[model samples]
Target: MRTVAARTTALAAVVTAIGLLPWLSGKDPALSVLRARSAEQEATEEALTAIRDDLGLGSGPVALLGRWADGVVHGDLGVSWVSGTDVLPSVISGLGVSLGLMGASLAVALLLAAALSTATLVRGARGTLRGGAATGGAPAAMLASVPEFLLATVLLIALGVWLGWLPTSGWQGPSSLVLPALAMGVPAGGLLGRLVDDALPAVFGERWVGLWRTSGVTSRRIAFAALRRAVPAIVPQFGLVAVGLTGGAVAVETVFAVPGIGRAALGAAKAQDLPMIQGAVLVLLVLGLTAGALAHLVRVRLLGPGLRDAALALPSPPRMRAGRVARAVPVVLAGVLLVVIGWGLLRDPFTVEATARLAAPSWAHPMGTDGLGRDVLARLGHGAASTVGVALAVCLISYLFALTIGFLPAFSAGVADIANALPPVIAGILVAAVLGPGTVGASVAVALISWPPLAAHASALVQETRAAGFLTAQQAIGSTPRRILTRHILPAVAGPVARHAVLRLPGIALALASLGFLGLGAQPPAPEWGLLLDESRAYVERAPWAALAPAAALALLAGFAVSLSAWAGAGPRGAAAPAKAVS
Candidate 1:
């Protein structure tokens, strides 16, 4: 009953929010429709009134919502404000394409996860916990850090254009699906594998495993059984992965020319076609909710009635302690970053040389030239101030906000739930509507949606730390609430949150890049990494280096974050800590 009520509340809230988008955007919907329908038309009150009345926009907000709700109940989704076509058919068709793509991507993710799990298990139980996991996690983190959009571009250039092994873009045969699926799958698989690997160590240490081994259970069978036991705990993560794949498909679809719901929604959002946007978003929302329910059902089947709700509870933090290799990796990355900055300071990224257009990598241009013949290395250097600098600023601001509200997560719990469910790209669109599409809008949007994770972490840490014996003793000793928070609570919460912020810095930068790539960030002639990649896409066949240079910069950033964060986040060097339940 509680589940049903919660879902119902969520459904009602989303529907009402969709109805209020035009009002919240502060854009004249009638004028927007006029522009979308005929860009040259002048905005007149008479014409505006006609459009408004025709679309029932003149009605009060309550009436408008009522009409929309009624239409939705009767299998009517209305028509697109821009295209003036039935919304239902287009939404359904696009949903089908997106679902097919999501299914393929999820299948690839599962296969990669299974392969990684098998390799980890094959190391034998003795070394699996300490040796195999520590070595395996860093590489997985590196792979996971490679953003899907960058991966898609690389695949298109190498596999599609260079080798001519597959179609570059479009919706045709099965060959068209390969690159996009791989692009979305690889990163997801790495994260999933890491989570599963974390869970498996706990099962291996269980007493039943040794008992089963002594009772003549085959080692392979025992491993398989352990996998079965570990998997149920993390089934929801796969569902989250599915939801992420769907949300991320917007960029992949734009890159690959897949006419999925994500692309359709993006186009609609760009045009401010409210009806189309709502319809598309509604479909995606339903798909996400459905996927979660299905995942829950699968977990139940895996465990049966007696242990259906039982899950492996694992403690958070320190999958691996600070090793020499971990410390060395970040230092090396920072040094390379300094070198790029020094080189960039000496060159002018904006000077266009028509004669050197699309030039390949050579000593004259270490990173080659873009389509406009702008030096790539210089742009990498100059763009750092915008791309990397903005990312750092955004992270700090997000952390501040997280620290402020995270102490009482319940206050923002509903908001966080909505934000987490919505794609970062969608957030970009909403921010663009209010602030206009540019660097500020993109940065604000990324920061806006990204804080919830930090806040969640802060909330968890506060809960865990507040329950500590030291904190309890201080309270009993007559420490004021303010002093406890300032002296003990804030310091405790800040440490983990800061480490988490550093770990998330790469992702924040990538989010900014994604928005830029989508034309929601820094405009052209800006030298931003995302804009550089976006421009390179046109002539990628001729100048892959133009793309690779910026990409390498981003990759190094991810490497630095993954390595140093591991060391910063490590707790104590001791036995694998006891597991904690997330469910």
Candidate 2:
């Protein structure tokens, strides 16, 4: 209770400090207006004025400062950059789109991830082939590699233009979001799969799981139970991903022609709209931090402390139950899905030679080639491969790097708190500007985005695991810190670390995809997803397929990765609490 109170007080202080910033910055509306007038007059005479005189106009700097201070005290976030506009409406509207997209993407990602992991980890259920795990895991790698714009473009072409199945773009209604959601959700689902896979193996090894098997509890029931237990830990990983989604909104919205805050931010960025950018960033920061705090609070409530020991203490049954194979039907089904999808992509198909040639459906063009005269089937294969390859490489490499660096400051609670306060996007933009954008820029962006979760998870894991008795016993035995960490600690926390990485996958995928869409990734003629969308803008009216196809593909791939990773992170019911509170 005391700790909670203290933390609450600290948060209040942060709020208060943020509130006082305008006043402290010497905002005076009357003086500001006077100065603005003087500057404008002088600039007109000198003919060198470049700044927007009308941006954030108010009373002089001092009065403006006072009102800002007063507003902060009264809980107002203030007006926006444009005249006669309240900032809150824009913030709220943008937030709604972002939240809706994230929610849909998250749901798809989790469901797919759960199904994929269950199939991959549970041995020999239905048609459970030897390489099921590899095939199932392949989606994450593929989806992560592709950018959202690319996926959306492919979807636009294949589903919208060719089939006329859905609307090509715009945010006036839900139909517009289908492709975007798919492009976003697929990759996320794939990423979540890793966590679910790793965590389940440990849960399956638990004594209670064995005991339950002996008790005649069905394998399906056991797996479901395990997921329930896993939720507390899994939720935080998703929360972090949610934060990343907010940062990624700009590109996805832009690609789909959705009028979300992301589009607004892009407009602001283009105009060098400083106040607008600051406002957008501030909103994003607040949202991210709020989500982080909420996740932390929930984890603390669910797992509390001493969860690791309880999980370890669960007893293994003497007589293991049979029918484990029978209960693994779901797992086998997922493996089939992976195989079918892979086979469809790899199987040889007919080709077309003439560009811009439209022909009746025939064996020669199974998927009916696109405007570029390339076989749609062939393009699909390459596109899927490219998308998944990039997603996996980026997720694995970026997460690994982040995990290592994040561990450094996590041990010190005070430092971790301070580090957590800083948002990664600010750093990412600065880095992007300096690097001037490319694969190198994407790498730096991923590294920056990947760091916070790595630090958060590593620190929390260390803190929680350190409290375990085995580690205490080792300490008493004079075990070296390095050995204890590498051998005892890391090994024990592998499940959680894997889960963290899985959960973090969606955000990383988004960041990579967004960068690509923004022309900061996979340069032209490379068939990059985002680049495809960027190029398709010219033909949105006449040939919406060019943009929609890549955009949809990107969204679907991302959604899949997020779902898979989330599923992997889920704990089984009756499974013990996570080694750490996964804040």
Model number with the top TM-score: 1
Residue range 519-571, candidate 2, lDDT tens digits: 66556555555555575566655655545555555555545543453344333
What TM-score, to 2 decimals, does candidate 2 have?
A: 0.56
- Candidate 2, which segments miss by more than 4 Å at Cα? 1-42, 45-84, 120-135, 304-447, 450-513, 519-533, 540-583
Error of 2 at 191 (Å): 2.1
RMSD of 1: 3.6
Alpha-carbon lDDT, every model: 0.76, 0.53
In model 1, the clashing pairs are 313-580, 314-580
lDDT of 1 by residue, 125-234 (tens): 43345542433555665666667777888888889988999999899989889999998888778777766766676677677877887788888887788788778878
Q: Could you tell me every candidate's TM-score relative to the true structure?
A: 0.91, 0.56
